[model samples]
Target: MKAFLPPTSYEYVTVHKVQGDDVREASDVLAAEEPLEIRVGYGPVGQREHRTISITMRTPGHDFELVAGFLLTEGIIRSRADLQGVLYCPDVQKEEERENVVRAELSPAAALDLPRLERHFYTSSSCGVCGKTSIEAVHAAGCPRLPPGGVRVPASVIHQLPERQRAAQELFEQTGGLHAAALFSPTGELRLLREDVGRHNALDKAIGAALFQDLLPLHEAVLLVSGRASFELVQKAAVAGIPVMAAVGAPSSLAVSAARNFGLTLCGFVRQQRFNIYCHEWRIS
Candidate 1:
């Protein structure tokens, strides 16, 4: 199934390179990056509206999932019921128009927060809403402290995720320029894996897949990231109701605080059969 995804997600580039002490021409694979404009359509019956919510650079594949996950975590739409449909805005006048812009239509009863959407204009995939004054803002936007006793995972299962995640990162193996996020069952079965040039985009793609699959409130899964855990990563996991987050790299100070505040089990340096649990230790056994 992974092979069925779009191959346009990466491109081969010719480069001037050095081989040992000799200069040589080289061709390398690069993860494709392009700007995606996400728009929202919501209001009341017979009063439908549309507005551009954000523009961020991301890889070319899994775009619908990316937009869905972004809207879910941003508190724009609560669940699948709130989403009417996701479509690429059709503009016959341009060739790239359909590929570059995504529009999410909402159900009639779903209220659009205009101000919140306006604030989202400043967000980028690299640092999601990082300029906000406080973490409370995120909480106010609908992030909740994850309920405890959600799921318990064996230590051995947790140790195997990185390898499993790597097995799915075909683009990363070629370019080494992408980040990945994989979702695993409580028993450690790998469920979904997504990769993007941006770490946040990768996580969003993973969450979006779950959202589309009617797997929200991810209380029975662990999210494994290929890189450091950032505050946005924890926030996204909390919004999606994922109980545990494991990263192959270290976590930031804000990520640790957000995990503790939101009651998530976060583990870092997950390699060599040893991992450092930073919060919610009860979930690991």
Candidate 2:
């Protein structure tokens, strides 16, 4: 069908014709960026040789933090102690096309819990404990009980995030489309923001940034997304131990369920002057 066109293909329509109808033209071209692979290593030299733990296509920056956060969210390294240092794959940094990945070097004693991690091939982005061989494994990992008292933000405060998030988007304004995830303090300060053509990748970048800063288990924080909340996103928040998630759009049914299941507060459809409390209403005043 004509409508099912590739991103690079642009079509034309007459928007304002001198004689007949007007024409408009547009295309689905997405910004192209590098995809990175994260590897786990345990050798005397650290990251000299290792096996790939996960592969994700990402925007071309923050490669080290991405490796750190990916390993963390995947439950590979619980704390920084398990990791030695993050480095570029020797060949990747040397090559122009393959420079997007970083290897997270682990201590020789460090490793993924084999019998526990082998339940299934980890899905593309379900970073929460939901994708384990058994739900019991999550409990075993000491996922940690989140504090029930969470950060509270007024609806008025929530309403301003969409516009604020957009205003900081340097790359998206040019591309006309991309996703962003930003961390905001309880009092509405913009802590950090990361953007990517993919919503998941954007979130990964944001999480990666936070991980690099030694900010894991964001129990006292709030996460705001440029778009709707999805199952994968809720899972991401869960792994990070973030207490609340707010989106400028709606939440998927699965995402809402995951939030409730994990005791994370979820808010959605936030714009201008209103927002929806998808899971916990108590978190919003």
TM-score of each: 0.92, 0.79
Using alpha carbons, what is the TM-score of model 2?
A: 0.79
Error of 2 at 91 (Å): 2.8
lDDT of 2: 0.69
**Candidate 2: tens digits of C-alpha lDDT, residues 36-140:** 777777656544556665667665555666677666665677777788888877775456645556777787767666554455334343444454332234435
lDDT of 1 by residue, 181-220 (tens): 9999988788899999899999988898899999999988
Report, for every candidate in turn, its global Cα lDDT versus the true structure.
0.86, 0.69
Regions of model 2 farther than 4 Å from truth: 1-30, 43-49, 92-97, 114-142
Candidate 2 lDDT score at position 244: 79
10 residues in a row with least lDDT, candidate 2: 1-10
Record all residue pairs in model 1 with backbone atoms less than 3 Å apart, i.e. clashing: none
